[model samples]
Target: MISCSPAEPVVPKEGGGNRERGAAPRWILADFDDTLAPGDSHAGLLRYILRRRIWPLLLLPVIALGGVVYLVPSQRRRGISLIWWAITLGLSPLGWRKLVRAYCHTRPGLFREAHRLLEEEGHRCWVLSASPRALVRAQLALQRPANLPYRTIGSRMHYRLGGLMPRFYCHGQHKLLPEICALDTELALSDSLHDLPLLGLGEQGWLINPTPARLEKARARLPHLMVKNWQL
Candidate 1:
């Protein structure tokens, strides 16, 4: 799976490395997937579907429905029909969230250094993930020790019969800023090109999971921001 770590061009910083030091510490805005938790949660869900041998059968009907819909007259091809079809036939919220929570629980840390900092420094840490809050909270409970000091700021959901439908998913360039605004955090951490909005909101932003290309790109843009290698 492709890494969600943001490239340098997107990160906004003065130069390179940490500028804030001493007792005046800053809050951290962190992305849950890839940045903090290693690996793709969505990919794990897909793997589960494949292992269960359920995807092929589950998708077939959806495809058939889509084909049938496409065959309908343009006037009948309403947005509500598509929404209803997705609600009725596509991925169920229960199954999807189960996969998501399971995957999140199993995720390894991408940036140990950053996590250590958050733990040691006692920063007001909040996980800003595209994932639902329940999923993040569950993973944190399962994977990280209860002693770990942090809270999660994530997407909300709505409960349905035997499932949960996502009301909104936090993503794209604009996603993290609102989280930062709501949380009032000064620092942020992420590992993706799409997290620039969140990164820019930080007084000090750290880019995790650096590659040769990504490192160079980040250096060119956010020179002051620290770029840490996750493997270390």
Candidate 2:
């Protein structure tokens, strides 16, 4: 293996040492949400809109309409409940995801660092997640790192009639192992126990904040698996 430390100082210069060593090439695989961003992007967006926009614009309006409905008699209020329900059902999920993606531009520095390190080491990198592609793509666009490879594999929704029609959640062998095999990644890094299939594909694997029970369990399941902490 090539030395990864800095080279020795030329002519033994004072207070100086050799140039820093470079690392070997390895593929990087990451999970989104808690692994990259500080928190759940999907939830964060919903909470922000609920607290800032939806509650006030929707709940307040509905409540005000309800109070007036009692005074205005039941005839005019026939469609008011239906209208309120429709508004709530429509605006809630839509507004929340939009706002969350906007607010979730701030991803974790640790994950970014890991990404950079693996990339600089000339490893292929990819994100494997269960999040929808729209959300993941939005976040990835914002967190574009110069040194890292660009690839995202995640859930996607099929739309019809101007609304969500089908939901796809990327998990199990469908999500993890396939990507690992396709990329031929030598190493995989992840924080969740569900990433076992992906980790098994790697020549070596690193788990972040792995619980003791999970570690033991993983080792038992993957006898040849190599485990290490993800410093970045």
Candidate 3:
């Protein structure tokens, strides 16, 4: 017969909580347009089309109508923008790619020191934008380091039945829903007050080169956000 002895108490493993926290990947959500580049990519694409193709000139009335539609309400703006895209620049994906490449070439300094710092910190970075996905992807591919792994979520366009269709419009206050549904955001970087919703989701928020009024508004909403100025 074996003699019974006092039971030893169980001890929690050292840094057990740290191990659990480390398992969850860190993600940095960055806005594409002004945050990455000096100007808005959507407006740049529109300008590119207007300068390169004469056909879009004939649709001046349609473009004007779209501009008016954009002012109506935030909910309806995406639809109007999509319609404008289809009418003006959605004729050929190949053509769009070429245009995007040409546009990116002029903006060599698109990827700034902030992006480098984020990457250096071992955080997975992604671009979230109201600009079309194709355009944003093309811009990143052109500007970012080849070895750095990054992804983009933005408005999507699909080619169906010999026409381009707007598949998704990731924008405005609702921009974070589509992105955060799949991944957790550790940090967020943006230049506009429009990204307030997205900035609110991040564990850390960075406002880059925001105007004084916009900065004040952001501070009121997210007082903890880190402010930094970046120039093109």
Candidate 4:
């Protein structure tokens, strides 16, 4: 596991970060897996469920189906959902959410920078992920009793194919966020190159989990990028 803290970046003086209470919320976006946290949530959940139950093995065929379906570029979300449905056969809506919450509580380590952003005042930061919304919300709940505030947008659970599956996942670079479409983004943070479009929305952007060579490449293009170290 890697231990990391946020690198302080220069924020423009007019908006975002530690602003007045009751003021209109400043928007920010954060990626979860491989950005704020280290790994893939869906994969993690599968392993978690597998260790506790025999069901995942019984549903291996479904995962195979998902694997085949995942080959198509546009149907990836649907493919992933099929795999999830198989892994989560026994859980109802509430049960699934409780499991997600429990999984998040058990795995509490996140990049220190993630906490700093949450604690800052006046920003209505939204943690965005391709992971399910429940997974995102559960992790945010772990920061409760303190922190500035938080919101989440991820793959939403909708009843489809006779089970609760992710209906709309935030995947590609141009994924639309209707909630913040009208507002000005103060900052954007993500690890993937696909998110450059989203990063452009913010006045400032932080690319998380960059390799040293990759960071150098980015700095060559944009010299002012901030830095933080991680202990692997």
Candidate 5:
């Protein structure tokens, strides 16, 4: 099972603690998939659908088409996510939760050292992901240790006419929307170069488990980012 080391206490500085009262909170913007979990929630969900035979093999073509759509530029990824949501619209909320919880239970080794280091430093952490908000929230709720506190921001889903629908796709550059951009982000962590825009929002960044080519590209684009190897 996934577990966390004991958190070190945050010592207040002299003179009744450091910094002026009402200072802007420092936050660590972290990616959910790969950064926290061993696998992607979206991919896990797809695997569940396949294993359960919830849909016929005929639907695979449509799913493949959605994947193609995701590769297109100019906000098309949002459309692709929406398509996937529509395809899975028949699943009840309780059923969805069960699937997510089962997936979370099987994935161990979450809360990596990098995560511990950030939290130990007393930074408020927020998970930022392109994955559907409900799935991300469910996984975090199951996997996160009680001692660690965190908030999550991800693509939202809306229930309309008794079906779940995509309300937002928080991926790529969209991860740095104005609401998120306004935060006093001290650091950001991510595995994919797609998160470069989000990484740029933070004063410092860490690229986790990136390919050598991707690392070189990120270094060229973000010279100040620290690269770290993380086994997932």
Candidate 6:
């Protein structure tokens, strides 16, 4: 609903990916959860927090409430926020990055091809994730080569509402705000239908490990959508 100025654009590096000489660099947007990493970062974050706490059971009611609220389409965002608050209730910002990084180190697996694509300089890849910003960065640092020439944008995990609310949700069509539109998108990669707004942007679309039904729905609108596989 509100307009924002575009972000500082990323200059393309020559000899990147597979582009012909003088060809425009392809712009790519990829999801983090279930796309790059097989596990959901938010779920992993909550699990990490719960295991460290003395009595995680105290947080159960709030978490349950969030799950119930999340079933309602209109209240899903707030529901997720409430669940985040519950997990982060007593956790301070201090040493959180270390914790997040530590958690990433223990993650099961990342899709090698997806991670490789992000590292490629031929195309400009932007990791547009719904996961918390710091969490995504921590995960990326463990896997991504340093200065591989890519960008990451993620949800703002503000501590407001007792850590329940976000400054920017960065989910669904909200990912297509002015700041993102500033970049030229030639491809999109995601697992969820919620990202149809972003997937619609480019000529090429990739469905990361989608179910048959979901793939069918996506192909209905994006005939160019190609399936990318990552097995658990």
Report the error of model 4 at residue 37, Å: 2.3
lDDT of 1 by residue, 1-232 (tens): 1112334235343323554666444466788778777765533544554455443555455435744764553422232233223433345667665666666645664357645755664346767776657666676666555434466766566654432334555664436443355443467778875565577666677888777787677656556567756752
- Angstrom error of the Cα, residue 139, model 5: value is 2.3
Instruction: Give TM per candidate.
Output: 0.63, 0.58, 0.80, 0.76, 0.80, 0.82
Candidate 1: list runs displaced more than 4 Å.
Answer: 1-25, 53-57, 60-105, 109-111, 159-165, 177-179, 182-184, 219-221
Instruction: State the local distance difference test value for candidate 2.
Output: 0.52
Pick the winner on lDDT between candidates 3 and 6: 6
Give RMSD (Å) of candidate 1 vs. truth: 8.1
Worst 10 residues of 3 by lDDT: 1-10
Tens digit of lDDT per residue, candidate 6, span 28-91? Answer: 7888899878978877877887687647558789889988998886677888888878877766
Residue 93 local lDDT, model 4: 74
lDDT of 5 by residue, 1-232 (tens): 1011112211111122344678977777888888766667776766665576555345667667767776776746655654555456577877767776776666664656744654474238878887887777776656545534366788787666554556777777777666666676677789888777777766778998888899998888777788877763
In model 6, the worst 10-residue window by lDDT is 5-14
lDDT of each: 0.57, 0.52, 0.66, 0.66, 0.67, 0.72
Q: Give the winner by TM-score.
A: 6
Steric overlap count per candidate: 13, 10, 0, 1, 0, 2
Error of 3 at 18 (Å): 6.1
How well does candidate 4 match the true structure in TM-score terms?
A: 0.76
* Candidate 2: worst-modelled 10 consecutive residues by lDDT: 4-13
